[model samples]
Target chain A: MDAASAAIVAKPASVDGLLDLASRDMAGVDALIRDRMQSEVPVIPALAEHLIGGSAKRLRPLLTIAAARLAGAKDDACLRLAASVEFIHTATLLHDDVVDSSELRRGKVAAHLIWGAPASVLVGDFLFARSFELMVEAGSMQALEILARASRVIAEGEVMQLTRSHDLNLPQDLYLEIIGAKTAELFAAAAEAGAVSAGATPEQQKNLRRFGKNLGLAFQLVDDALDYSGEAGTLGKNAGDDFREGKATLPLLLAIARTGPSEKAFWDRAVARREQEEGDFEKARRLIAETGAETATLELAARYADDAKAALAAFSSSNSWRPAMEELADFAVQRKM
Target chain B: MDAASAAIVAKPASVDGLLDLASRDMAGVDALIRDRMQSEVPVIPALAEHLIGGSAKRLRPLLTIAAARLAGAKDDACLRLAASVEFIHTATLLHDDVVDSSELRRGKVAAHLIWGAPASVLVGDFLFARSFELMVEAGSMQALEILARASRVIAEGEVMQLTRSHDLNLPQDLYLEIIGAKTAELFAAAAEAGAVSAGATPEQQKNLRRFGKNLGLAFQLVDDALDYSGEAGTLGKNAGDDFREGKATLPLLLAIARTGPSEKAFWDRAVARREQEEGDFEKARRLIAETGAETATLELAARYADDAKAALAAFSSSNSWRPAMEELADFAVQRKM
Candidate 1:
């Protein structure tokens, strides 16, 4: 069997194992998130509650907490950093829903849809500001620098996505660059900041960041593949959202990379022109599956998952936290969303 | 003459003189703003250029730079703080234009109007992150805390304004509180951060912040009045915009405060229902003039200006920069916009 079949047959890692491993730290993070989300202005808390009170996992904050624990942190500064990292992630999601004109987020109505765009935008700013305040309270300049730089890179990636939205193919290198900045940068930073909070060695910090970056890439790839995988509950939002919005995702990009002028024209007319007829999404999904883009994307994701696990190999085998982190990477590839 | 009459006749201080006083430091800030605005993502810089390349006064940075010099700053850190202060101001302006659905900003078309709201918002986020990076680079925890808290307050104030937009009779205290957070907090933070960068005594920091807070109040009052004052160049955007948007301004609030059955009906129709006729702005302006509300507003602004000036009196009667700061406060009230 090929590597793709090997990946497809592989048993997924247990996410519950990692979560249980970091259960205490996760509880602290959740408490911090709840406390910091409150504001004197009633609407701030109202909007925050609406956005955060959902079934969606606080994965980014979990990573921060887990990374800190894995690196042997002593104090509660990682709790603050974990909360801050999640705030940034949540803030970005709020703004992104507005930008994408998304109708649903985390299996619920988008905050921007309920509140006006203006209020949503301001509340996102509030959360971003609060995140920085947490970093300041943490009193780590290194953590502050990493997260702040990640935020700038995230915004840059968003703009690049917007600008490149004009072109359909979007090029492989640019797609990687965009996803690296948009998704992986924050993941990398969250892990690095956690390591920094623990006062980890430079090499340890670099290893943790590498683990996170590869894990993030795998997570995004799996998510992108899931859009066309014809699986319900795999996407937080409606399936074919990427198709309807003409957003270039990995599966679609891989499908576009295949040879066929007719196939190219079909995508150009459907996605580039946004002139989708009835059954177009069905056709697009079928075409993607026919080309085995979903399988290919998932295979690539599994590769990254392996890379993430390898990055953590330098950590002592005796350190039980390292195994959980490796399992977390596998879970990133295996998760439906 | 009545007290209002005396205020109308008062000779305010020179703004150009204050700008001149801080010209050398202002150059450093301008250079920093230009350099920091650049991003690897082309659209980031492109959107920033459209927003920042205009008729912006950047008064916030001027106060920061001037206050630092007055407080005896020894290094170029104040220049970084000044630039960061201005970036925060610029970021809010970008988001404000989108929130207000503004057609113009800084005497040019709004960035949202040009780049679309999504791009405008993301770029605003980018600039805001860049501002935090600057604060972190300044390496003053005090400065970071001040600016971060101010940014959060600014967002809260914006949400408060949105919540209160339904009520024409938004109470005076709430109005003060809203504007204090939305406008004055940043000004206060700017001053405080400058003093922090300078490593000034706590007393000096308090005085500078007091000066900035009052000056911001005075500045906002004048701007609120200018919407009805019927001037062209005074406003960066179109005149009567506040009236059209039905946004609560000091002139409108003062006009509503006057007790008359017919007055209440008129405002209810114009602001609450937003059912103004073609000549309604003319009538609103005439009514404001007739009630001495604009004059009253200006008088109140002038009083804040006096308080702002008084805050600096303890610094030194002989500090060359002190008189310039006093002039800047006076200019905040006397300026057309």
Candidate 2:
């Protein structure tokens, strides 16, 4: 092993120590990403550099690297695998913006807004193709199978969302299914790939995958809850963006189910018209609180977070991944955005 | 083999001769496609059935079936492979219409115009994912590799087209490169997969793939040439559409190289403005014909057709596939639209 790999193998004694480890390991993958993203098309490099260079928590890749380190495998291949997850995530964002016709992402104009829809769509396709090529280089059919299945699940979830749009009767189970396929699948795959690459035993890989899956579900539940409850400034956008779009997210679903006849008309109009007047946002917010949907949503998020923490019980007390996994569960529900 | 496999093997021989083989084999695949395309989303089934039910000639899938038959391999696998090609081709068309913001395709409003852009984009992704699932069931990694590579090439060609848009300096070589990747790669893969499924020798499979590749190239060149010369009513769109879009196709590239100073200025303005007045279109058409660019483009298409025909020489003269291959070559140039 090289100097970087040797240092990465050493145990991090604290949260700051883990962050330092993550930062150093991610630097190599980040550089590799920067190198491959260059294109003669002026718009490509500009959009890629901006979106990729922009501040991202890097949680997904960090989970991948941390999981591999916990499994006692530290190698350059793990770094490449970690980078592959980031590329896949970034590619999905580009396509998602185009499909949603989204204007703002991460508080900035979307790639489609600046580069036009065609360029953004095609560049997203390029990133997806490049990601497959990168995974192919990893020489693991198992990893390819995991990533491919995750991609298909993500696409299907997006389709399900499209199909469910504005339908106030969307069952909570269906909503959970959509979130699991779209968000948790990728998280699970990332952690599973890390463990598999590190040659973890089958049972350990399953536990790690379950941990990531629960964590992802919790993360998305919190995201949906925050759409109704988060501060607009802190979230970098207005609260109720999903409600404005007529998305039948968790809070709205729960609220509609719990509302009385008097509030049903208001909910119907809000969902059908997908528009809120000056005071309508406040009324809707009050209704959600009164119906106890806010509490239910947060409670559900907490339940998933607890499940995530419990999955770590499969690992021994001496394993360094335990604390990081616990912190990730906290990060899922506790983040401001 | 089962009864269906036996029927597939025996039916092609009863289809009169090699030339009629394509149409006969296409009927079964077309019926299978229509049956399989049923969906819970009303818009999905409506749009997919309408598009796939149109006059596509089923050339790609026919190439696959013909190549397999030529290789002396007969099974149910060919039907699955043929349907897989059509599914992928249809999916790409759905996505391409959105990317191009195209109003009309096959003489009708595109799916996006009918159901809106988000629906079209998401449904397109659904079909793409579905194609993978279908291919996976075929259970051949070699087939998977071919289809995956073709998809990557198609996306790369699309990116190249997006990058080269409105750039008058695009060279003929680059134009060929783009078309080869965008158009020919899928056709080649379709044929190659047929041979692969049928367990053909490597050399025979390569020859069939080459044949499909050249034929696809020739077909695209002819289509591009007709965009400048064919009647608007016959071709289902206005002549000079590529020129209006500032697309650097073969005829325009040749015209620019051969025209005089005054004609060159006209070319520059017409291409730069993209949408030209009647007078501009007339002058541009006159200059292109006067410089023999039309004839030169025809010659190029014919040469590719010949190349396609020659690729079939590897098969014995007595083989049924040889004449069907020749007919495909001829049909590549003979089409009015």
Candidate 3:
């Protein structure tokens, strides 16, 4: 097998071993998600059927279900909470495509490209409203509070990221802060809601939430790294797309910080002007490699993965949730796409 | 004085009477609305300073406060609820300009034109999220549920309108339904929430809400009529802008329904196509007048105003809110801009 295929095969074996431990417990949650994702609006149902019924990793919902199971109170409430997280995640994706002006998502023409921007935006609003309605039905004030705050943070992070575009001076701390608000907060909320639904002890819920947050951070860092290194076809997008858009992701940010003034000028002209040609992309890759930015970024992602695994140590080692939680940590750093 | 000036002078005398009735009771509610509209974000503060701090009529908030007072409540909660309603209304305007690609509003460059679409959309989301946060702080689940559902319906109505663009055959029932969801529901919610917040009896709240709903219907129909008849400079927009956009407002819908075969082809080529030259505009206007569509629309709007006034019979004449409620019903039918 080719190196990429070999790597993919190795990772799933680890995931399989983890899933075997808790497969039965997750079945009902999965079914609930499939049911609630359906919509009554004709266009909505068609769009959703194509998008949600396709191959989604369902990572966020999995975290919620696992967290609930670990809390030791399996019930229908957990299923509803899990569905809420997935809906919010889906809603954000719909809006994000509009913000990014993306033409394709998940190998399909984006909804905005097909239906029009106004329709896509309103549909995204519909999903957001629907998600809130579902959360309210969950009937926990604390859950409502958590989800609302997370949604606001996500929006704020997006605005901050927009303002920071092409600014090579962005610090690693700022990068972490942005990702924490935009991505990790939702992940953390998903786990917390699951624990809350299942009546987990406060301390246990906090620990599980921390685990999800760290895992999410690591997941995003790895995603940014892969933008520079992954194959375009496999990623289902052009390689270096972030660089083309002048988004200063981890590898680019670190490289700018470490590189000399002369190399920095090249990046400033290319990315800040959003004028990267064929040769400029190669130079960016080489500069990132020469400055050890790629390696440093990967190391940071690995550290986060390790931290995530350690956070789960508060639970019993023999618990069924233990293995799935570990695979999540591993997946954070090792996934190809 | 000329006949029109005499009528204008006479109208303000009635307005003065309404203001005298509600002035003392409304001071605290007005002050609360002014305070909570402030924002900490630089863009938010700048935009709000220009938009909300301007001389807005504050009609919606006044209806909310007046409805609460009519229900015999004098609590701070009503003020906060009124502020929340206004915030949601303003947020929609910010986003709507971007959706419509409008260059001007209220005789100035629109917020999106001034700040860019991305900023407009994000700021709009911030305001929306902040409004929900405010409602949550109000600590009323019932209020949150009502406002949340209203928001969803408004968004759905927007999408429905987008889909129906330039369709001259749009049914009058569908047109009213769309406006009711998009415009009237919020008015009803504003009134209902005021009463709900102040612990009004259920029957009183229901009557006041119905009053607001009917009043809102009249208000929108008059606004649509003014699009064809109002002065361009005074209205802060071009006359016949709705006709140019092929919006099936009540008048246009009525005109299309009544058009004979001879003029139907003209509407199909000009109005339905939304491609109007100077001659086409004049011809279309003449045709609509000849069909008596304009008069029919005015009659329908007046009927709603009558229904709105009838709803106030439940409250005693001595109630402090009675005069302002009556003026609001009259204003709904008579406003020129």
Candidate 4:
């Protein structure tokens, strides 16, 4: 656990290489996920099936399984930990949909839209409590505390975002804190718990945490950028969602900073009122591009990805896990998703 | 610890004696709760305060603290566990308000109606995750596991209630299972965790679990009856809430059993449609009274309360905790709340 403060990662590494390296373990995590997600109450399994069964997010679980690989683990606690991480992610998505009033998720209708907000909220809770049970079964109090704290931080972040919505003057640091807590906290905890489950040295655990945190930051940055990219095409999610929801993402913030009075009025009317005139989305996209906001977003994402890879410097480069994770960091920024 | 499986509570005991017995410990639990519920996210605490701060039951925490007393705990883990139990209960209440579209709670406007459903739902998540942190901090894996499992069961029970909604012919035992899981599970877990934190023997923990479970069942049965009690006047919660919500509570279910064709048709319209005409509640009240539904409901509650008291017999009649708890069981059905 001593690596708690390390912050270094390498050049862009292949995301596919990362997945291929742990394909077998990834399969196990999925199987465990499918089994654990079932419930005797039919609505439970039906609803859970719709949400979890829809996504193929092998990323968070892959990070967990890969972290264990780096730690030379022979036990399967990593599998349970990985599944728990996915469950946490899925649970948050359910609740997030309810909070954001999102109509779509992963290109499919949001669970809340189909099942109603009540089911989505309660089922999310069911998944969360079930996640804790898995944490306990993994037999690591440290892991449990880390994940539990992360979960709390995630909720706080969501609340922060909610409270900060549509405020064009939203500070950069506060925005970062919101995303860090809302997204990166889970990523960081997943990597840390994987290390803990594998009995990694404190230093190694700290390194993994840093790696996960930076990678997560890079990924979220890309997501925010993609929201304005128009052709984002990630998870089949439509772009301009942040705008429509009156969320003050980085693109809008960056572009707004450089806009004239007329443009500023444009953003204020479009975002503040959450009222998009026809072609407003297209005009917003053009403004964001003219300001080079997407490039800036991607540039920062790349830097964070580098930090994520560099965090693994203490590990042997000869160790496939390190290089694979570095590539995964690269994918965090480069992929459409 | 010898109280495990012991069955020998006397006649229904006085509920106030139990509350009086734990008065000092309840104060400590309340203090801990106030400290823990605060959050840097002002809305987190603001929304939370509106829900938990407005009214006080202090009953759930009381059971936890009192159970620890039964096992002679010397440490403060019981206080943390008690606080955690209360947080979980409060979180559920927040979510329940959103689910039921409840306009009021604790005789006041529901948080959802004031803060909005998004804030209420997200804050509920924050409280739940914070609760797990508390469980971990209590330093008893046994307590953590028991509470986590209980939390999951509560979610399942809620989902069951939702799925079973509008089914006038819902099975009696199935209804029991629903209430048992939704309400009794947490109470049982709280008492069991208390014993575990006290380092009680497995036998003692089992006994306490049984005691808490039966007491919870009694408590819930009374709540179901009180929904039709007309002047429940406890906690300032509105009566006919269940009837209006079309929830198939015990009184409604029992009363329906005695109704003829016309009465059955009336119930079918009111409950299934969840659309109450003027004077419908009055008619429903009359029917329940004529059928002795309230009496039957109280009788069942008393039976469970007796079971709750009997579960504490092994603690020795001389032990004041046992007597108080026995009396507490009696209070389950007797209280206006």
List lDDT for all candidates, in order.
Answer: 0.86, 0.75, 0.74, 0.85
Q: Evaluated on chain B only, what are the TM-scores of all the candidate structures, in order?
A: 0.96, 0.90, 0.90, 0.94
How should the candidates be ordered by DockQ, best one leading?
A: 1, 4, 3, 2
Encode model 1's per-residue lDDT on A42-92: one tens digit a residue.
889898998887675877887888788888898979989999999999899
lDDT of 1 at B22: 83
lDDT of 2 by residue, A1-337 (tens): 4322232356322334456657777787788678767755566668777678866667777778777777777676677777778877887788888877776676677789888888776676666656665665665667666776676677667767877868888888989998997788888888888888888889888988988898889888888888888887677545777877888888888888888676778877877676566777677778778888977887787778778778778777677667767766766766658
Model 4: fraction of native contacts: 0.87
Best by DockQ: 1
Residue-wise lDDT of candidate 4 within B1-337, one digit each (tens)?
Answer: 1121122233434557877877878777778777877888999988887777847676777889889998888888898999999999989999998999887687778899988999999999999998999998898888999999999999999999988977888888999999999999999999999999999989999999999999999999988887787473565677888899999988898888888676877998899886689999888988988898888888888889889878898887887888788778877777776
Candidate DockQ scores, in order: 0.90, 0.32, 0.48, 0.81
Which is better, 1 or 3, measured by lDDT? 1
Best by TM-score: 1
Which is superior by TM-score, 1 or 3? 1
lDDT per residue for candidate 3 within B182-283, as digits (tens), equals: 788888888888778878788888888889889888888877887777777777666677777777888877777787676787788777876567687667
Of candidate 1 chain A, the 10-residue stretch with the lowest lDDT total is: A2-11
Tens digit per residue, CA lDDT, model 4, A63-180:
8888888988889999888999998998999999999888878778888888899999999999998898888888889999989999999999999999997799888788888999
Error of 2 at A17 (Å): 7.3
What TM-score number comes out for model 2?
Answer: 0.83
Superior candidate under lDDT, 2 versus 3: 2
> Candidate 1 or 4, higher lDDT?
1
